[model samples]
Target: MSINWDLYNKRLNLHGSTQRDRLTKEFKIAKESKASSNPSCKTVKVNGIDKQVFIVAKSDKTKFSISPVNSSDTLQMGDKIFWKNADWLITELSLDDDVYVSGTIQQCNYTLPFQLNTSDIIQEPCIISDNQTTVGQDQNKIITVPDTLKHILIQYNSNTVQLQKGKRIFIDKQVENPSVYEVTKIDRITHMVGEHGLLELTCEEGQVTEKDRSDLLIADYVSVLPTPPVSDLCEITYSGFPEIKVGTSKTFTAVFKDESGNVLTDVMPIWNVIVPNGYESYVSFSEDGMKLIVTVASEFDLIGQTITIKLSNVDNPDGITLDVKVVSLF
Candidate 1:
C-alpha cells in the first residue's frame, strides 16, 4: 500500500489552522537561512495553495506541526515555534513529502539564562527542558538545550580553562534558594535552524531532596529575562579632587558604569586609602558608601605627597581602580 504523505501533511496543517489559525496567533520562527542571517518563518496562506506549517494538539496532549513552508527550508529538529504562550521546540521531524514537512515538538519547561562572559556580558536566549531516565528515580536530569546555543556549547567543550568558562548558565527563582544543576555529561547533536546545532547535558540536580525543590518556584523565560541583572564594570566616573584645607573634611562621589556608559545600579565600591605615613585615620566613608570624606590634618602639609583614594567595583573583581589625588590649599 502506498502512503499519501503529502495529503497527510496537508491534513495536519489544516487541523492546526481550524483550531488556532496562524493569522490571529502567528507562529513566529527566527532562524538564519541562505537569504537572511535571522529569517522569520513565512508560510503560504492557510487558504493558499502552499504549505502552511502550524501547531496542533494531539490525542496525548502533545503538540504536532506540519511546516509546508514556501521556502527551500523544511521544518527540522530544534526549530522553535512560539505559539499559544509557549515555546514549542521541534525535537522530531519527518520529510517524506518534498512539498510539506511534519515534526513533533515539546514544551520548553525552563530558560537557561546563558551568559557569554566576555568584555560585554551577553545574555543568550536559551530555552531548555529536562528529563529523567526514570521519573522520580534519581536526581539526574537530561538538559536539552536547543540548537541556538551552538557557539556557546563549543566554548563549553574547549580543553582550555579560559575558553571553557566563556559561558555560564543559571536558573534563578523568587524563592530563597534557586535550583542548581551540575553537569554530568556534555554532548551535541546536529539540528537545523537554517543550520544550527544543539547541546544536551546530563545535569544532576543539586537540591536532591524533594523538600528542597526550588526550581518549581523558578520564574519562566519571560519573567527572568528582565530581572536577572548582569553588570560588568567598564569604567568609573568620579568627582575631581577637591582642594583640602588643613584640618578640614571634603567629600567625593563616583559612578560605576559599563561599556555603553549605562550606570550600573545597586553596585557598591570598595574604597581604599593609601596615605603617606600617619594619615590612615583621616579618610572615612559614608554609611551607604556613596561618599568618601577625607579630613586632612594640619601636620600633613606635604603638597607632593598624595593620598591614593582607590575604589574598586565589586561587580567585576578585576574592577577599575581610580586615583583621587588630594592637594592641600595652605
Candidate 2:
C-alpha cells in the first residue's frame, strides 16, 4: 500500500505550537499528571508519617512503594516526600516492596520571583514607600543664586527685621519662585525716606529686584531698593614724581572722590610706592595731608628702574585704588 503523499506533505508543512501556547499547554499538562515511580526519585520523608518511599520519576502507572532508604529507620505509608533540587513535596506512599515507588500528585505552591525595574522606580517624595518626615534644618539647606545676579532687594511688611551691612540671599528671575534677600542696610525710616521706599540688601551683584511680592506674607510693606546710579567720580587718585636718579627727592599725592566729583575727606589717604628691584615704600598722612614726600636713597640705581604709586583709603572701600606709573628720571 502506497503512503498518502498529500497527507504526509500537509503534516510536514504544519507549524509547531507558538512559544506562548506551548508553555501554557505544558504547565496545564504537568499540573494534571500524576507522580512518578522510581526508588532513586524518592528523596525526603516527613516524621510520624506512613513508612513509604515517594518516588518522582518517569513511569506509566505513576505509583510507588514506600520504603525507608535506611533499614534502621521506621517510616509508615502515606508519608510525605521532599526533593532537594526541585523542592517538590510528596503526599502519598505505599509500604509494599513489590509496589512501584511513586509520590502523591499535588499542586506546587510555587511563587514567581519578584523583579524590580529601576527606570520605573520613582524617588522618595514621589513614592509612597518613604513615610518619614524630611528634616528642614537651616544647616542642611544651602541657598544658591545665579551667576548673572548683580544685586538683590529684600522687601518686608514692617521694619522689625533690621537690615545689616552684609548678608546673603538668593534670586532667580527666570523661574516663578520667590527671591530671597538678606538685610544690607535700613538707612532711614519709612516716613523719612523717599516715596519708593528703601530696604537695601546684600546679595549677588545682579539680584536686586523682586518680580513678585504679593504672596510674601510679611509684617510691614517693604521692598528691595532699586540699583543706585553708578557715579563717574574718581574713587582714588595717585600722584608721584617720575624716576629719581641715584640721589634725588620725590613727592607723591593721591585724591579720593565719591559718586559726585566732590572730594572725600572722611579718612586719611595712604600711599604705596614700589621701585623696580627695590624695597617697598609705605607712607601715611593726616586727613588734611594728601601729599607725600620722600627722598630717594643715594645707593638707588636709576637705570632700567621705574616707580609705581598706589593710593587707597580706609580698608580700601570697595577694594578700589588708583595707580600711577612713573618712568622719567628726576
Residue-level lDDT of model 1, residues 142-213, one tens digit each, is 554332222222212222122222122344544566655545555554443334334555454444344222
| lDDT (Cα, tens digit) per residue for candidate 2, span 34-82 | 2244334344535324333334444534433343443234433222234
Clashing pairs in 1: 147-197
Model 2 residue 174 distance off true place after TM-score fit, in angstroms:
15
What TM-score, to 2 decimals, does candidate 1 have? 0.37
Off by over 4 Å in 1: 1-52, 69-73, 118-168, 190-197, 207-330
Supply candidate 2's per-residue lDDT for 80. 29
Number of colliding residue pairs in model 1:
1
Q: What Cα-based lDDT does every candidate model obtain?
A: 0.48, 0.38
TM-score of each: 0.37, 0.24
Stretches > 4 Å off in candidate 2: 1-246, 278-288, 315-330
lDDT of 1 at 329: 62
C-alpha RMSD values across all candidates: 16.6, 31.0
